[model samples]
Target: MTETIAPTPNTLPARSIAPWLKFTLELGPLLLFFFANSRPKLFAPLVHPFLPAKLLEGESAGLFTATAVLMVAVLVALIVSYAITRRLPIMPLVTAILVVIFGGLTFYFQDPSFIKMKPTILYACFGLALLGGLVFNKPLLPVVLDNTMSLTETGWRILTLRWGVCFLFLAVLNEVIWRTMSTDHWVLFKFPGTMILIFIFTFSQVPLIMKHELRGDAAAKAPEHL
Candidate 1:
């Protein structure tokens, strides 16, 4: 008699959500935040019944409203991702956690600065975490990238180091932008501007990824021990 083995998390089907859909899920919240911030008055009524009374009644109301919308949008995106993939990516999960914490603080204290600091904190934590992983010989970029491609240990190390530094750079950039620019400008930079920079950086890494890419037997034997 043949024994039927049940699938565990590690052995589960690999049919995750499409890349486009995943990208949309990640970008949707940021776009919503940008839109909500740009036209808070239009979105105020939609979120008014749900947010605290005080959050909608100040000079910072636009930011407050945008924060609330951002929080909700991020949660919704996570839910959709889970529904489709049966798992959440580590980076987005961490991002959602920061959004909730910082967003809550922003609402509770009626301060927009908390929300402004969220990106800085998120990027710095990711940067540190990635760099920290390398200290122990663990390449965590795979986890963040959801193990999309296979690479040699040397390749992983180089890629991970580059990403860690890039993330730190982005963290510093966020601080500078938010501190020096107007709220509207900051919001614009936060979404498309940030997204653009990441895309450019990612494309710039293509040659490195291609050069170090594992193939055939080598790819098959690539470690999953990130």
Candidate 2:
């Protein structure tokens, strides 16, 4: 009798949430972050009941308030996601961990610098992780992306490389923006700016994805031997 091998996490099909819901979960917190920072007075009352009184005062008040809101919103999003899917997606889970840690530090130290550095650290870690996977002969972009599309190994390699580079570039860009620009400007760039860039980059890769995409007959036959 032949033994059957179990599928690994990478090979398992993703339990995907609705596209709209996923978008809301991801972008909602960001928009709230911007809103809270821009209008801290609005969120202050809501969050004041939970956070330290000292963290919500003075010039950094808006930023600190936004950080608190962001931390809570991210946790809520994760909880909603897990409740719906019964499993947390890896990328969001990692992001939430970083948000809580960095946001906590920003609140505790009463400094906005930590929150400003979160994006740089998050993107850098993602970029390095993808590159590291390539070095180990493992294409990890699909894993991070939840294997939404099927592609040839070569395609995965190329796509992974592109995303890895893009992530690193975004990391550098975040550092530049936060270090040189005002907090408000940085928030603006972090939201619509980063979203626009990612959308453009993603659309630009459509041709590459189509070129290497596994299709009807090929897809059906590719795994027959297995």
Candidate 3:
């Protein structure tokens, strides 16, 4: 039998959202984006707030169906995430909530622009929240990643800053891609490609984090368990 070697000082699990689960969670938004972009009104009825219930009951069947599907998918993803993690994560939970709201708006207003602008909304929210955290001398990354890595407060600060910047970059990239590239390219990039990019970026920062590593309970538990 071959011995399997794990990554040295692997800060986190290789799988973030798991395989099939991740696909189910992320794929919904992509499909909604494409459908809405192509059909334009594919999600308008179920997306809006002030629209009468009969609005979906009367006109725009296609848009209603698409928005309904999108809502179900978002709910499923959120449920799965909460189930697995035993608590909601900051980013994905926020993503889910925004997807519902924006997706609803896209369907309700019969305007593709609202849904198209989803990335900008997400990016701006996270950017502001992170920057706010920094201003208060509080780094939120560790709270989300606390179970995964052992690092000092300064390490957390550095990591959060890098990620905050990366998220901002993603926001810009999303704008450029959606504006320039085909919808297919944007969706494909959003899924596995984004995950890979984040992994690589996070790994590159491992050394910097390790430099400020703390001997926490995860360290303390190692020998005791052994």
Best by lDDT: 1
Off by over 4 Å in 2: 1-15, 220-226
Per-model TM-score, in order, reads 0.93, 0.89, 0.64
Clash pairs (backbone) in predicted model 3: 42-63, 43-107, 44-107, 44-108, 45-107, 47-104, 47-105, 48-108
Q: Whose TM-score is higher: candidate 2's or candidate 3's?
A: 2
Please, what are the lDDT tens digits per residue for candidate 1 over residues 64-161? 88898989999999989887777777989999999999999987777799899999999999999899999998989998888889988898899999
- Stretches > 4 Å off in candidate 3: 1-68, 83-86, 216-226
lDDT of each: 0.89, 0.88, 0.65
The better candidate by TM-score, 1 or 2, is 1
Candidate 1 accuracy as lDDT: 0.89
Q: Give the count of colliding residue pairs in each prediction.
A: 0, 0, 8
Model 2 scores a TM of 0.89
**Tens digits of per-residue lDDT for model 2 on 1-226?**
9998887865564366899999999999999999999999999889998878877887778889999899999999999998777678888999899999999888777789999999999999999988999999887888787667778888888999999999999999999999998888999999889999999999999999999999988766543210
Candidate 3 residue-wise lDDT, 1-226, digit = tens: 9998765643334335566876566666656644753454545544555455554443344444444555666778778776664556666777778878987787668664565567777886776667678888887776655345666667777877888888888788878877887555665566556667878997999789879776767555532100
lDDT score at residue 149, model 1, on the 0-100 scale: 91
Predicted model with the maximum TM-score: 1
